[model samples]
Target: MAELESPRVMSKLISFLSSLLQRVAESNDLNRRLQPQKISVFHGLTRPTISIENYLDRILKYANCSPSCFIVSYIYLDRFTQRQPALPINSFNVHRLLITSVMVAAKFMDDMYYNNAYYAKVGGISTAEMNFLEVDFLFGLGFHLNVTPTTFHTYCSYLQREMLMQPPTINSAESSLCMGKSSKLHLCFNDDESSHQQQQQQQLAV
Candidate 1:
């Protein structure tokens, strides 16, 4: 847990989230430009009006969950999207999904996490809505809450590599080169699935 709170870990988490927000922004911009006719029919039409950075800042300041919980929340987000193909992460639902994932991760990973009501208040949502979202997200994830050490490290490494590959600014001429380097990092995880599964099985047997 202490390791989770370390500066390195926190930086990696922030970088990972920043990348996701960047993607969301790009996707929204592309939709606005290339699909103007279909924009009104987009699922993100009902998405929250809040900025992703501001929303994440609110959670960082008020959620009071372990820093590790944020990392776990990222993992849950990945698993949730994989399991529920219908609910892809995007601007329309990402904010709500972030709050639900972090709340659920905190509850599962922290022994002293706040209750659903408190989480609702922190997330600026009704308690009942929070409860409903929690239930829905749990089912969406199929209750696979356990993350092995190997998997955790793999994610951390991936985020760190991405951070290193991100150009300092959007207009940098080297941005494309940096993105190419980042794409290569996916190979690091290509062989991780079998090892991660084996680690999970060993832990379960213990």
Candidate 2:
């Protein structure tokens, strides 16, 4: 009985983690797909994907960023998505938006932001490169950076709830996973992009 239960328990945990990561990737892809695609950056492609998760992933990896950064980035994307009346933006344009959103998010959310980010060091090509990407992203979303999920009413409710709960990891990861996806939030648009990236690589141009 113990042996059987162990496999079942592990199976459930793996499923939960996979589901969480899927939620994150979905959010990320949604934001990317909403970009305007009528640009050169999206053409000349095969085995195409919705966004440059790799480019965004690279920039994020090179930066001394935080979870707050992901929050802010997702917020920015949500805001942009909400305001934009258009869709099907190319991957390049979306990538630019995400990078700029991260920069803008850092400025808005943190006291001191990282300046003088060298492209070589940060995995971006250059400041000009950054600007170019930001502009395109901004253009696609129509510069809608005002609205976001972080400020949503339900999010506020969850924060209040999270504060009341015992601190995270006090319970097993499975316990945390079982609580719920809506409030627990194992994934979101900007977060969890790295999870299951291997499957993503197989399916995408990356």
Candidate 3:
């Protein structure tokens, strides 16, 4: 787990997310271009005006959550989208979703976490709205927040692979590959009956 929280891992995650947001932004542009005749009415909602990189940086600075919290938040985002297909991660709702997921993951995975009011301040929303988003996001995820270590590492490995598949711009390709290899080795090392039993005990305790 410590390996997942390392600076290298965090940097790669940030880069991967930046790339993802860029792709989303580009896709939105393409859609708008292709559908120029039709008024793009996204459930009567406007896309978020803030830049994704800036919003992510704000969360990284003020959320004060562990790196693992962000990783777990990514996992929750995946689950949320899978469970709630109508609420896809696009420009319109990605910012709110990101903030809500991070807040929920911090609360579930960390012993110490800020309340909704504090998260609202960090996320630039009102406390009441934050509360609403929290409740809605929890239901969207079906309240499933228990992430086993194996699942955690598996997500990390996927992110690493994604980073590797992208073109190397900042010399992250080698590091991402190394991280993927390391996570696979770690998974193998932890694949034992004792570790499985321990995880079950931890789940029950949760």
- Compose the digit string of candidate 1's lDDT tens values, residues 1-206: 34566767675556567566556445544454443322211134465777766777788877777787787787787776556544445566677778898888777666566677777777777878888888888888787777777777767665566666762233211111122235521112222333222111111110
| Cα lDDT of model 2 by residue, 22-114, tens digit | 344344345554443233332233422533545555655554454355444655555454444343222334444546667655544555456
Model 3 Cα RMSD, Å? Answer: 8.9
**CA lDDT of each prediction against the hidden true structure:** 0.61, 0.42, 0.63
In model 1, residue pairs whose N, Cα or C atoms come closer than 3 Å (at least 3 residues apart or on different chains), thus clashing, are none
Error of 1 at 45 (Å): 6.3
The true-versus-predicted C-alpha distance at residue 188 of model 3, in Å, is 21
| TM-score, predicted candidate 1 vs. hidden true structure | 0.70
Highest lDDT: give the candidate number.
3
Pick by lDDT: 1 or 3, better one: 3
lDDT of 3 by residue, 81-169 (tens): 55654444556667787889898888877666677888888777788888888888888878777778877887677667767787323
What lDDT does candidate 2 reach at residue 204? Answer: 12
Better of 1 and 2 by lDDT: 1
